[model samples]
Target: MKVAVDQGLCCGAGQCVLVAPEVFDQQEEDGRVILLDPEPGEGHAAAVREAAATCPTGAVRLVDGD
Candidate 1:
C-alpha cells in the first residue's frame, strides 16, 4: 500500500503516529503528522489503514492498492 498525508490539513491529532509509528511520526515543534514510510510493507498495511481511519482531520490518505 502507498501512503500520503496532507500536512496542510493536519491538526496534530497524533492518532496516526500512535497507530502506525513505523509509518508515521509527529513534528516535535508543531505536532504535525509526518509520513515515515510512503510505501510501507504489507505487514504494516493494517496499521496504516487504521491510522488513516483514526485521523481526526482525515489528513492521512492511501492509494495504489491500499
Candidate 2:
C-alpha cells in the first residue's frame, strides 16, 4: 500500500500524526501532515489506516495494491 497526504487539504490538526507517529508527522511551523513513511512496512498498515480514518480533513489517502 501507498500512503499520501494532501497539503492543501490539511489543516494541521495533527490527528494523523498522533495516530501513526511512525508513518506521519506535522510540519514544525504549520503543523501540516507529513509522511514519514509513504510506503511503510506491513506492520504499520493498521496504523496508517487509522491515521487516514482519523484525519479530520481527510487529507490522507491510502492507495491499495492490486
Candidate 3:
C-alpha cells in the first residue's frame, strides 16, 4: 500500500501518527501529519488503513495496489 498525507488538511491531532508510527509521523514544528513511508510494506497495510480512517482531518490517505 501507498500512504500519503495532505498536510494542508491536517489539524495536528496526531491520531495518524499514533495509529501507524511506522508509516506516519507528526511534524515538530506544527504537529501536522507527515508521511514517514510513502510506500509501506504489505505487513503494514492494515495499520496504514487504520491510520487513514482514524485521522480526524482525513489527512492520511491510502492508495491501494501501490
- By lDDT, the best candidate is 1
For candidate 2, the per-residue lDDT at 7 reads: 96
For every candidate, C-alpha RMSD to the true structure in Å: 0.8, 1.5, 1.5
For candidate 2, the 10 contiguous residues with the lowest summed lDDT are 57-66
Candidate that beats the other on TM-score, 1 or 3, i.e. the better one: 1
In candidate 3, list every pair of residues with a backbone clash: none
* C-alpha RMSD (angstroms) for model 3: 1.5
Name the lDDT of candidate 2: 0.87
Q: Which ranking of candidates, highest lDDT first?
A: 1, 2, 3
lDDT of 1 at 29: 95
Minimal lDDT window, size 10, model 3: 57-66
TM-score of each: 0.94, 0.90, 0.89
Q: Report the C-alpha lDDT of model 3 over 1-66, residue by residue, as the tens digit.
A: 677789999999998878778888888999997787898887888888888888888888876644
lDDT of each: 0.92, 0.87, 0.83
Question: Rank by TM-score, descending?
Answer: 1, 2, 3
Checking candidate 2 for backbone clashes, the offending pairs are none
lDDT score, candidate 1: 0.92
Please give the distance, in angstroms, between residue 60's alpha carbon in candidate 1 and its true position after superposition: 0.3
